[model samples]
Target: MIETPASIVADRKSVYGLRTYISLFSSAGIGCYGFKLEGFQCIASVELLEKRLKIQRYNNKCTLDSGYICGDMTQEETHNAILREYDLWHNAFGIKELDVLIATPPCQGMSVANHKKGNELKRNSLVVESITMVKRLKPRFFIFENVRAFLRSICTDVDGVDKSIESAIDSNLSGDYNILYKVVNFKDYGCPSSRTRTLVIGVRKDQLEVTPYDIFPDKQPEKTLRETIGHL
Candidate 1:
């Protein structure tokens, strides 16, 4: 069934008291929809394309106009805009910290399905922008999602040194956060179709009660391709 913005908003009426979150590279709101459904209130979301942002807005991913940002993640202006929205949330909610940050950077360069996979693909470096935000905003929990090869992919770090994406994340955040990286099939986690992806989860050091292992869900019964899409 297709879900309308009104339906989503009505169903999520109780979410105002839940943990607040923000999204980066939130293309059409697909990646963050699960978070929203789980009662995480998305206060701000950024997408580079206006068309995609329009879809997100229609879905009510962020109800506030200031929270729906459409701009280049690599640009300083875009970063400032996101930060401004974060500040607004702090003031509106009377809180100094964000609950969660969900970022799914473009995976074309890191995906095995891409025939043109190489360091020449500038999109691969966009993960650095996500990492930069973690440093600046310091959300209590952060999630980075991408293709299974994300950690193995090479990208220039904040220090301008070529390093694996895993190393860059560790070098930048391991000190302040307890992080874990895992590769899993979405089918094993109750998704209808099979999808292999990498997930990097980080919990701020101060959030000692919850570890990455506690956040990652246990495996579920696998679903077959035919079982998932046979009707179509």
Candidate 2:
């Protein structure tokens, strides 16, 4: 269920109630938003970094209701364990389906900062792992976020030549899901950060609506970094 502005404000207390099952993968930004929405109550979360796991537990007060799995998602055993632990296969939540799945795979390979180096090779396979998890979880909605440079990364085609990132996503999720991609700047969304991110939202074809992009604000007030900084 996509949340509306009025509902976000009026039903803030129960906003998470609408989402009984949520899976967050290698998510740091979501953790920030989770605090605001009390998203620690999500059914399951997975993080590979120990420091990040510590922070998640501390911030969430080690909540027992939600399960946190710490391991590399590239491993099949880890992936299978997450499925069994979350009971996603059995639909134990009684909703008959998982609500949402969010993933922000390591972006170093797709980041401009790694230019000229072979960091791309290091992080290339993680993208496939992320997509694999999405295919297995089969959530109602899935969101993937990454750096703008990701749009430039090339994927090897059958001809052994490079193809655009859009082509890569199209080949991976075309018939199984309908994907909407957008490049957004935080400043344009009234956030102080000049941070720009590429967000890809995937909805099963059966769930297509009149406007898949209508969920976000069309226009937002601009905000400056000064307005967001605190003085010491």
Candidate 3:
């Protein structure tokens, strides 16, 4: 059972069900929230930073068995290595599909450091690749985390070039994917950071009825930084 705070900040139970295999991408091996799921196990994790991977491996040592894959996700060799380690392949891992995939691609393009350079060729290309992976994996559910600028940037296309992120993703995926895009704040979800992120959730359309949003409503009051920091 989840420990009850004075009030529920986010109803995780509504979002994820019991006993799931989760794949975390480009983050510190599946942030604290993933641990909150009652039976959710992070079977596979990917991180680019060596230091962050070390920290994640150490902290989540007991929870994660195979260890986190440290490298870029876009590289074919890196992706193959991760799949092999996780036994994601048919007959080998005995696992056919994953339950959930959570990715926080680099937000540098949308970050304040980039000053609205979200449309950079490299950044946009990475985002496209991330989406393509989603179509290939076809997990029951997926969560994409990016800076707020992601929602604001206008997609572009060169002559005969399909540069739109959504277009690239759609071309790869079947027509049955249902996606929900929203801008969320960590503060409102009981985190101390004032970070605001654009989240895109994709699920097979037939499964949309089971989506967790109904159980977890938006518009929850923000938990002040002071309230969170005091506990630390």
Q: lDDT winner among the candidates? A: 1
- Model 3 local distance difference test score: 0.58
Candidate numbers, best TM-score first, in rank order: 1, 2, 3
- lDDT (C-alpha) at residue 169 in model 3: 46
Which residue pairs of candidate 3 clash?
A: none
In candidate 3, what are the lDDT values of residues 134-215, reduced to their tens digit? 6666777777777786755433332235445555545544375666777888777766668787777777666757663642
Error of 3 at 109 (Å): 1.3
Clashes of 2: 0
* Candidate 1 lDDT by residue in tens digits, 1-232: 2233343355435545446788999999988898877767677899988999889878877846678898899999999998988776666554568889999999898877889755644787899999999999999999999998999888888898888999999999999999999999998987887899999999999996999999998898887778767899
Better of 2 and 3 by TM-score: 2
Off by over 4 Å in 3: 1-18, 30-37, 61-65, 88-96, 116-119, 152-162, 215-219
Native RMSD of candidate 2 (Å) = 6.1
Angstrom error at residue 89, model 2: 9.2
RMSD of each: 4.8, 6.1, 7.2
